[model samples]
Target: MDSYEKLSYVSITPHAEFLRNFVANTICHSCKTSQRKRCINMADDHNLCSECYKTAVFSIERLPYIVHNLRKFYRQFNLKVDKNIPIFLTDKVEMRKEFDDKTTHSMTVYAKKSTTLVIKNCLWQGEKMEAVKEPKKLSKISILLRFGYPDVITGARLAHEMMNVWLGNKGCMDIQQNIKEGICKVMAYKWLDWYFCNYVDSSSDNGRLGLRYIQIYKPEIESNRAFRGAKMAVDKYGLKHTLKHIVNTRNLPDVNQATALVKIMNEPNEINTVLLAQEEMVEQRTSRKMGLIFS
Candidate 1:
């Protein structure tokens, strides 16, 4: 897959087996049962026994609330758009066929130009005339999210795609693929962390389930070496500074350069000492490893 595509994987497990194993060790928040015939874990701090789970699943709809919350969460980033982008809950088959067999969770489509009629001026013989046959080039953005994912998973996918939208809107689409996708991954991971901290009740059963999901998802997002490196940059510098650097330079900040700058700044009078010390540390470590190999 192209690094720029920004794909996420989904894990599908049988509902029956999932429930059986889930309730085996964890207490159901709804029925307060550690041992139940069947139980299902849910997002938002609610684990339910078989009957309660069925009732909750059948009667309660959480997608709208999730979407609303996500929209609200996105606004906090301050990535403004001239208009609202449309989001559609779609099936996997409707998504790109290349990812059909790959268990793709969601995708954002950005079109450089959408079809629209525009007036064109022309001179017929001697007089000027207007023609309407030509089409104007206008950019379009839309999100296609596969239905049936758990609420939290759906939220994460939406968060990822929304970052894509933000990048496109900001005209950062021309940047290097690894760097662009790495930024998207960073945003998605940040959203997941924010969601867990602000929304999930860490003390509740649902909160525990949410944390487990975050643990599983975060590593997958960070699996890319570029993504990991980008995250390190964000950690060392602030997000605002990191983002500004990416936008201004169209590249990730050089780690070696940043480290040297930090050293120089911290010990301005001992710049040479710092450099020599760093070089000596590297040589000493290499010498110890070589000695171990020879011995």
Candidate 2:
């Protein structure tokens, strides 16, 4: 299997040269240098060359078909991709599947590494779901917003990367299948928070941590101080059960105040006002409940 293409920015593929001679009168709106083989024609008078057109169309439009073909390819070949193997997209393709039996053909997906055939309890081999349609109109910004920046790669090329890399051919453990099958709940900002939580070790240089725990916490941890206070509380209390304590005890709405509170929490000698408030609130609540029960 050819190594899959991994693109960080969008550009024209060399194969696009084959497509250029066939197209007439259309110029690539993106690179102006390449004679566009096809125009995305996304909007009024707006057109992208063959490479840009494919990138925009395939990343969103051809995702389902590509996924279907990959599933079928895996099933027919009985190849096993290890759980830890890293996959990449390649320019090479060995097969093409149409969207249906009638209309013109769709995009082609590059094949992956081939090994000895071994049939296991495959997860994707089940009843097929109706294909989800990609919206006809999508801005470049929308594409970037939904799925990060577009690297110059064919939709089939990108599909190759997605299948081998993120989607990992782990039978039932496949994220592509899980997402398409609706087996796992998908959330927007959770991806962002997950990235930050794992990659970012500390708050930003200006003492700012952008809403790290906003999705889970009520009233939302919007400030750095509240986040630090929450962290301190998490160390003492816990994540799942500490929202009430953080919300009630520490309210650092101002950035400056939050910064100051963080300093307090860090110092061993100084009393952390937020932590003190939390402890006091817990004691007060406990006493009140005890008094009511006794009375």
Candidate 3:
């Protein structure tokens, strides 16, 4: 029987003894060597040796890319990736979406013999149990070492952004799930930032005449901050009105004011106090620059 077909005969066993025995007996999906205590359970009933598992963990955020590139790297020398090795992933699926459904419904896993895992808790219905401790952040040093120069800097920047999003989500400590959710959130934020920038940048000259340019060119602004600023201005200033209403309005806020509005929205209490103290200084500086105030 084929290896995949052999997996069908394997029962879903949650007994710790079974996990140990399985590891001891199975040939590593990577090296095809029966290395005792060196196997880890992977998706779709496969197991990888410690060395192969470490490689996968190192490529966590960019697993698919790394796998593809690995083949390409070897192909340059006219070789193929070893076919005997197992691919742990059965299907490419969004991690967050899959886990979100499980979490939301409080679904618990129970080891079944073949297809599904099922457990009956009827006998211990009233038993008390200790709460599960939250998971901690996973280290990425191995992954970081793989990058060089600008790639390292870029990776650090994105990782920072992803951490912010993850924290904002009150992320669970589960390392794999956290990373997946963070990646999804970062991608969404980037799309929105790009959308807004392109929409504003591509508008006609009349629409781009003044302060809007500042928003278009705001360097290194977080997408969430930009979004909050736009939202605040729209809600507070009735920016939803017709273009005629906007054009006829007097003392309309310029782009700098809009960005300041964003900052205030994001850090309301702290920014309010700080802005009050700095307002006079900023005004004086502006006046001097415009030659309205002599030095």
Candidate 4:
């Protein structure tokens, strides 16, 4: 499967087992010490102590607020899409099968026509009554996330999936998979950074835990080649310019080209000269190719 199909995270299994065997001799993935009395093994193959487990599970009720915050955060970058996109939480078994058990955290699926039930309100004798459902076909984009994770992880995953939605809305869905995933990862990383800096308070225990996880995960994201390249582009050229180039050309600009463009912009007098020279070279190449074909 293409890497873009799903977002994967570093599994705590190996680290947990290593700590259990050598370091702290504890089965718990979090709080590696053996002091906790009870440890529960989760379906995803990580053992969390009672106290840690309580905070590890995310609540579905908070999903709407996360989505709302993401939409608000995206506005600063001028990324906008439908206010409502169906997001569902699924079991580890289903997610594992879909991602071939690569430790996937989330996936976004696009459909041309999806069957959905629409309710029609019915009234009898001017009183509110039952509602009837009818199957309706609609184009939609849906996000499926694994059932359990901390709030920070869920927010980051949703932010990544929402970037896919934005791409589809901007008609840039056909771009190369690496570029697409790279941009999405960048957005997710940005969201994490924003969350840590603005929302999280390091004074509290829960806030500190969230910040720690964000620190661990952000580095993993930076390790991916696509993500690294995109981040470099964004850092050097700015997000607005980099995104605009991607949308216009359907490709990431090479370092040399980006540098030259920046130089051309910085030096106003050289803009026409640089552009005309580049255009002339292209014309000459085209003429030469045509002559060779005719000959």
Candidate 5:
């Protein structure tokens, strides 16, 4: 790209022609332009002069853009997300709208029978139990990683789930019946951050933007790419025997494996328990004529 086309941090080429045509519109009678008032994108209010707008456009719009983008301006920044992770996205079927009958209520009510995971508490539970709650410090991303991406759920599922949740009651809203859904939503949002956004440069800062663009564009991955790459490295040099030696095993269900684990549990403080002293010489010195005391 040439210098002329290079993206500038500031400076906007106003659409004077568009604004003029719009201002001339019969519906725009109340606009500041009708009173010979200048309207700059930087203005706090539409009535402000172009000279005053010199500093307002970039800074003020940051907050309002975030708001408007989610609402009426969805089409402006509605990103194309890719499904790379095995994340799932589903919408509610408006069965309730069709019937106000009992069957509709029964189907809509997702909360089914609840079952206890532990029927018999452990010996530790025999004592008085304290209020058990989740650690509040765990963010959504941390929670998803802790859960380690549930079965058949991928990053793609996460991205869409996040979008749905973020929109709240709008745009394909539905009840998330599973705890993993909550996890997936959080993962989806973070995943979205990485997929969306157009960064100006390839540097780390802009690299972040580029990544955000990707997350927004492509949400799911079919494989754990880094892990797959590592697996490929395993066959790089036909070092199968080397890995076997490192593992140190005979056949299945080896007793040595258990013994090795136990030894590891109570590790030695010092290596090779050996002393230079001779038992015979020490016994000779300590023996007070006590049965020759020799080994």
Candidate 6:
């Protein structure tokens, strides 16, 4: 596959480019530039242009989404929690069948009250669910406010990254045929990425880590608003399971706060080229893995 246009995020490859040229030259990423210093991005391992290098060199801003991404990933994947989240605010949920094939399946969820969530499982050739449980509500926003932490927002790019990884993998066991789950994972990664990129990316002597010193720590509210809107799009598109996995647990080391941001990057690409043909059942049947003849 031509990685640049690949259907998966690993195919969405990152590159080291001249940073200033990117801002004035390209509008794809958020722009930040004035003084130049050469440095490298540690997480994705891309070289930073000189303007970006200075902030990392002079002050103490850290890399993006290292811990929160790792922690969120470990908890859902390793701990075996259902990363599918339906409605975060109310926590009520129900799950039902969407798609079923020998190699692929999908489910839906709905919420009731007091954050009560329901999940259903229907698969063609896979094992049946042992049971489903109502998920615990993430701590209330009021509590986080009392504790004086940044309110969690959706992590956009991180979720996209996870989705790409899940979908793009050559093996079915990698993330399984759980297409609904694949959506959830992508949501998580994107929400966190939005948080981290805003928190971690900047040029300043008194950096983002020292945010406590400032009376206001909301330079990124515009991005935050954008993310929330995208998240709402998820809700509108009927993907609540995705919203839950992407919300951050409260608490952070100041240096690692960007990790929390990784929980909800909050930006959804306008183009869903990867799943453009997903609605076409015939195309899905003719897909490489399964060769079922549709009725």
Ranking of all predicted structures according to lDDT, beginning with the best and ending with the worst: 4, 1, 3, 2, 6, 5
Which candidate ranks first by lDDT, i.e. highest? Answer: 4
CA lDDT, every model vs. true structure:
0.56, 0.29, 0.30, 0.63, 0.26, 0.28
Better of 2 and 4 by TM-score: 4
Per-residue error for 285 in candidate 3, Å, reads: 66
Over 4 Å off, model 1: 1-64, 81-83, 98-103, 112-139, 258-295
Model 2, runs deviating above 4 Å = 1-40, 43-46, 50-253, 264-295
Model 4, span 1-295: residue lDDT tens: 5322243333455334323433223455544544544554454455555445445433345577888888876876666868777776654555564457566778876874655433222111111112233344444676777644566777888898888888888889899999998989988888887676557666677776766667677887989999988887876665665777788889877766677558644564554455435434544654564355348
Per-residue alpha-carbon lDDT of model 5 for 166-196, expressed as tens digits? 3332322243333223322333333333223
lDDT of 2 by residue, 212-253 (tens): 222222122223342343344444432222323223342212
Per-residue lDDT of model 3, residues 1-295, tens digit only: 3222222222333233233433444556434443455454543234544443332322224434434543442232232333322121111122122243321211111121222111111010111111111122222211111111111122223333333332323422333433333333332333233323323333444223212322322232335453344333333433222111223332223444456445544564553445334433443543453353123
Give the residue spans of candidate 6 off by over 4 A.
Answer: 1-31, 34-51, 54-68, 73-159, 167-230, 236-295
- Pick by TM-score: which candidate is best? 4
RMSD to the true structure for each prediction, in A, is: 17.9, 20.7, 22.7, 17.1, 28.6, 24.3
> What residue runs in model 5 are displaced by over 4 Å at the alpha carbon?
1-63, 68-73, 76-176, 179-197, 208-295
| Per-model TM-score versus the true fold | 0.56, 0.20, 0.18, 0.66, 0.18, 0.24
Which pairs of residues collide in model 1?
A: 45-206
User: Model 3, which residues run further than 4 Å from truth?
Assistant: 1-22, 34-37, 57-60, 64-295
Q: Per-residue lDDT for 31 in model 2?
A: 42
lDDT of 6 at 241: 22
